[model samples]
Target chain A: MIRHIVLFTWTDDATDEQKATVTAELRKLPDAIPELRSYTVGPDAGINQGNHAYGVVADFDSADDYLVYRDHPLHQAVIAEHIKPILAARAAVQIEV
Target chain B: MIRHIVLFTWTDDATDEQKATVTAELRKLPDAIPELRSYTVGPDAGINQGNHAYGVVADFDSADDYLVYRDHPLHQAVIAEHIKPILAARAAVQIEV
Candidate 1:
């Protein structure tokens, strides 16, 4: 399996409503993309300082499956319309499991 | 459960051996720390451009359990001895799963 994890740090000016929209839109992805074997998205738990504001962890059977999710229209739209507007810094990694 | 994900970008001078050491050392943490419910660590799969070099995803039953793994001496040693020396950038998030 391949695990794709992304961390996002919102811009200082980003509003909470915008952040919530990102989460809501992300929560709809598993249903919209069949290749997703597992998915989890949420705000940071605030257990530590200096942590990114949000995270997404998605699993797929193979790299090819991950690519489908990566380029899916719904996924791209969420990134373009919701995430990009508030994004400050982003880091992502996809790893074999 | 609480899922803790951390992304890392290695310093330009970091060698393959150093990165390998970091992976090998991190693989030992689940056995060393009892609170970890699940853990995955690996270099990026290279399916995307401009992604972080590596990622770690760890799951714990609760926030307090995560704290135990977070502060574990063995885990800290791996960071101090292997990762910190070659660390370039890091982003982490702990979220409810």
Candidate 2:
């Protein structure tokens, strides 16, 4: 299995509504993308309150499937429309398991 | 459930043996710590070749359980004895799911 993990820190001034909109849009991705085998997204519980405020973990059968998910128009649309505006920093790790 | 996600980048000069030792030590945590409901650790497949070289995803019943795992002597020992020397950077997100 290939796992793609992304951690995001929202821009300081981004409203709760914007964050909610981004979260809801991300939550819809698994249903829209056939290559995404599983998806999980949530906000940090803030024990440390580090830079990352939210995270998304998704699984794919192979790296190719992951690439497909990454390049999918719907995924791109979400990034361009919802993510970029409020995203402060993003970090990701992709690995086979 | 609370999920603790950590990403690590090994020091450029760190040896393969050191990285392997760290991975093995982390893989043993679930058995050593009863509070660890699940544990997954592995190196990055390097599709993006981003800063993080390895990732760990571990789950617990609650945030308190996660704290126990974090503060456990075994974990602290591992960080001090095995992780800190070869670690370059670390990023994490903890959230209730």
Candidate 3:
């Protein structure tokens, strides 16, 4: 499986309500991308002593599957409309397992 | 290979110079921990429309090796002195590949 992991940190100016909306929108990605085998998005536990705002994990059958998910229309929409607009800082990496 | 990815976003109050110092400290991790096969840390490109300050990725021989790297004293020191104290938000995940 190939797992794509993304983490976001919103600034203090970015309200809790804003993160909630982005979380809701991101959660809809699995339904939009067939190659995605599993998906999750949630807030950090607040115990890690970091500014982490949220976490996202998605798994695919292979690297190619993950590539497709990366370019899928829904994913693009989220990047452009939601993530691109709201994210204060983000990081992502994909691992093959 | 097992990959451990960690991303952090510093608050606006965090100076670029501060990130540079943390980046330097974090980059020293691989040599300190024998289990860390490879590691990378750097500033986020400003165009991504997010608050992300830096990124860290390290590959391990296996999950057990990753666990060892996780608990290593060098990593703990970096976390306590640099990461934990400076991070506004952070996220991490491990993938077996």
Please report the candidate that would top DockQ against the real structure: 1
Clashes of each: 0, 0, 14
lDDT of 1 by residue, B1-97 (tens): 9999999999999999999999999999988898988999999989999999999999999999998988899999999999999999999999998
Go through the candidates in order and give each one's C-alpha lDDT.
Answer: 0.95, 0.87, 0.70
lDDT of 3 by residue, A1-97 (tens): 6656687766667667777778788778877788889776677544335435666767788877877887888888877876666677667656444
Stretches of candidate 2 above 4 Å error?
none
Chain B TM-score for all candidates, comma-separated: 0.98, 0.95, 0.88
Query: Tens digits of per-residue lDDT for model 3 on B1-97?
Result: 6666677767767766767778788778777787888775666544224435666667788878877887888888878877776678766655444
**TM-score of every candidate:** 0.98, 0.94, 0.54
In model 2, what lDDT does residue A60 have? 96
Share of the reference A-B contacts seen in candidate 3:
0.08
- Highest TM-score: which candidate? 1
Evaluate every candidate with DockQ and list the scores.
Answer: 0.94, 0.68, 0.10
Instruction: Provide the DockQ value for model 2.
Output: 0.68
Task: List CA RMSD, all candidates.
Answer: 0.8, 1.3, 8.1
Write down the lDDT that model 3 would get: 0.70
Candidate 3 Cα RMSD (Å): 8.1
lDDT of 1 by residue, A1-81 (tens): 999999999999999999999999999999989999999999998989999999999999999999999999999999999
lDDT of 2 by residue, A11-79 (tens): 989999998888899888888898999887888888985548888888899999999999999999999
- Model 1 scores a C-alpha lDDT of 0.95
